[model samples]
Target: MDPVLIMADDDSDHKIERRRGPSTSTLSFSGIIAVAGLLASGVATYNAVQNDIASLKRGELYQERTNERLSEELKSVRIEQRETMKEFNEKLDRIIDQWARGRKQ
Candidate 1:
């Protein structure tokens, strides 16, 4: 082989080796951070769901209690109204009887 040609071949073969540079470390670090973030997000979502369920249960219990209280109040009011109506009717009957007696006389 010609000397010049061989030297040219050696130079071409000795070309600078390719390096990963900072990309390798950056990718590894980014991957680890991304995985950690995903885990954290999952945990947060789970907690939020649990909290929502608990809150709903509490609200439901409160609503049931409120409904029961309102129902009791409505029942008492109805009973009072019935008693008042009975008394009014009795008074009206007495007045009507007296009026009828006066008319007859």
Candidate 2:
């Protein structure tokens, strides 16, 4: 097909010319390669994002397990502390009773 051109004339003997606009048939092989490359880049980016999300999920699961273990350890320590305190108080009471008896005699 013959491409159309626009011509403009001014009164002072000056002229302007414009070429026809490009159509889909005018797209070159390089343009097609560029489009394909863009699509591939998008796919690569999406895969990277998915991998990042999976890694974060694994890290979150590990953290949850660690927290549970720490909580159990803390409970055990508290129970042990309570038992130690009870034994100390009993020993103090017995010593006080012995001192009182000695003073009476």
Candidate 3:
């Protein structure tokens, strides 16, 4: 193979030196660093996802509790309304009966 020629200085004496690139060890080390960075990024993403899931679960639980409280409130209101209607009906019946008796006399 022909050696690479490089001009060192602008002089009468010309020197030829082979061109050198990055060594194997340097390339391997750089590759390892890149892989490590990728792994770290993946771990960060996973942790973020887990945190989001936990937040969602907490929100769901809060909503469920709120729904239960509202349901209880609704049930109490219904019971109170039913009682009021029963009392009103009883009063109306008594009034009607009293009127009928008065008319008979």
Candidate 4:
């Protein structure tokens, strides 16, 4: 009895190797880039919010200073008006008293 033998010789027959699937490294690199892009966008949004808050604070401070100045001006104007009215009333009273004395004489 003789045993059957099988042998493969290089360049004698064409054999195709089936690929399993896509490479893991390619998918991993794509995922990493996506995460990095998301993180960068979040940082940019946070910085923009901070700058807006700072600007709002500055606007409020400016408004407060303007209100203080207006209040002081209003106080000064009231004082001047009171002084003018008092002087006018005193002069009218003196004129009326003199007229009454002349009538008696």
Candidate 5:
């Protein structure tokens, strides 16, 4: 190669090298931070979803228990009403019989 041309090419290469210098370390650090942030966000989202599922399950269980309790209470009330109705009918029949006897006498 000619000396003058080689020297000019070396100078140009040096300028390009300087312009592109030492970027890998900065890019590597930035990539690491980005990955860390992504992982943290994913973990937080997973935990929130798990908590929501747990809450939904608990709510379902509570609703089921409430329904059972209401059904039992309704059954007890119906039984009591029937018993009361039976007693009232017996008393009414006795009153009618006594009134008829008194009228006949």
Candidate 6:
């Protein structure tokens, strides 16, 4: 530790004295509290970011599943439409054939 010299006045002559000041190693109460609050805030921010990332992942998964289901449903509807068209065309052809034969007779 460094000491500061102080001068004093006496009856006959002047005298010299030593004094001490605040130490660098020790922190005040308010300083300690401020540091602790900073640490707590940092921890809270980190956790919040982690939670947001997880939520985004879940949302992505849900969207992919919904898209897959929609594709499958569209494929099934196309197949059903194809079958209906085939049946209608066969019945029309049969009717045309019968009309032509009746006209010939």
Top TM-score prediction, candidate number: 1
Clash count for candidate 1 is: 0
Clashing residue pairs in candidate 4 are none
Best by the lDDT measure: 1
Per-prediction TM-score = 0.75, 0.67, 0.68, 0.65, 0.70, 0.62
lDDT of 3 at 45: 100
Q: In candidate 3, residue 5 scores what lDDT?
A: 30
Q: Judging by lDDT, tell me the better candidate of 1 and 4.
A: 1
lDDT per residue as tens, model 5, 1-105: 999888987787555334565588898999999999999999999999999999999999999999999999999999999999999999999999999999999
lDDT of model 1, residue 13: 58
The residue-by-residue lDDT of candidate 6 on 1-105, one tens digit each, is 223323222233754466866555455766788999999999999999999999999999999999999999999999999999999999999999999999999
For model 2, the stretches where C-alpha displacement exceeds 4 angstroms are 1-26
Q: What's the TM for model 2?
A: 0.67
Please give the CA lDDT of all the candidate structures.
0.95, 0.86, 0.92, 0.90, 0.94, 0.85
Any residue pairs clashing in model 2, and if so which?
none
Per-prediction CA RMSD (Å): 6.5, 7.5, 6.2, 10.8, 7.6, 7.8
Q: In candidate 1, what are the lDDT values of residues 14-41, reduced to their tens digit? A: 6766865678789899999999999999
Off by over 4 Å in 5: 1-22
lDDT of 1 at 24: 77
Order of candidate numbers by lDDT, starting with the best: 1, 5, 3, 4, 2, 6
**Clashes found in each candidate (C-alpha, N, C closer than 3 A):** 0, 0, 0, 0, 0, 0
Clash tally for model 4: 0
Error of 3 at 71 (Å): 1.9
